[model samples]
Target: MAQLIDLKTFTDKRGNLTVIEKVVPFDIKRIFYIYGVDESKRGGHRHKQTIQAAICIQGSCRIYNNNGSSEAYFELNRPDKCLLIQPEDWHTMDQFTPDAILMVLASEYFDANDYIFEPYSAV
Candidate 1:
């Protein structure tokens, strides 16, 4: 199952900075981003080995994830909030605002074999 986590934020007049280090669930290896997304579009798959932490760096979006037996919906609105997705969790990201930008930190490099295409049942 995946969990929504509050990232550590540092601020002192130089704006706020969000940090997710090795102390988090997994060590980051691959960094990718998605933006200019349409509200009607969605991410429609899951991973087999890659662990992911998704953050909405620009605007708000909702992630629909299913953990085999159950499902849940998580909102990514703040830059300091991260949603950790495990290998078996089937997920789809949709309901994106006009200016939404999503940043993902992965535990491994891109490997096509690690991907799983599964239909999600939102809860």
Candidate 2:
């Protein structure tokens, strides 16, 4: 199943600083961001070998995850909030705020065979 975690954050007079380190379970090979989305949804599939950590660096968005037998929903509204998506967890991102900037750290490089578009129920 996907897990939601809080990133370490430091706040002071200068503002807030959030850091991503030591917590991710895999070595990151790819980094990407999603922004300027309309009402449409994104990520309607799971991965075969890619684990991902998603952070809403700007605004907010809702994520739906299903790992075969279980399911969960996560809201990433802050830079300090992260959603760890396992390779087996099927997920979708929606309900994005206008200014939402979702950054994803991936465990593997791009491979067409690594993607599974079918839902868990269909599998």
Candidate 3:
């Protein structure tokens, strides 16, 4: 299953400042961002050992997650909305707004063997 975490934000006349602190269960080892996607979806697979937290820092996107027994859909429309995806959760991201910038924080370094391309049923 995937969990949604709201990041802490501080607002003032100057602006708003959001922070990513101790909420994530693992230490982040890789950071990436997705943008400029038009009519196409992303993330069709799940990891074998990595955990990821995704945040739409600019616009909005929808995430569909399936973990063998259950399924869930998450709309990340705010910068403070963080979706934590576990290793077993097979997820796909789509319906991205033009300005959307989806940032992902991963718990493990890049390893081809860590990725499982097949869905839960095939795996």
lDDT per residue for candidate 3 within 5-108, as digits (tens), equals 99999999999999999999999999999999998989999989999999999999999999888898999999999999999999999999999999999999
Candidate 1 residue-wise lDDT, 1-123, digit = tens = 889888889998889987776545777899998888875757678888988999999999999889787888999999999899998888899988889999999999999899889665454
Off by over 4 Å in 2: none
Each prediction's whole-model lDDT (CA):
0.86, 0.95, 0.95
Q: Where is the poorest 10-residue window by lDDT in model 3?
A: 114-123
In candidate 2, clashing pairs total: 0
What is candidate 2's local distance difference test score? Answer: 0.95
Q: Against the hidden reference, what TM-scores do the models get?
A: 0.89, 0.97, 0.96
Task: List candidate 1 segments past 4 Å from native.
Answer: 120-123
lDDT of 2 by residue, 30-75 (tens): 9999999999999999999999999999999999999999988999
The local lDDT score (0 to 100) that residue 60 gets in candidate 2 is 98
Residue 10, model 3, lDDT: 97
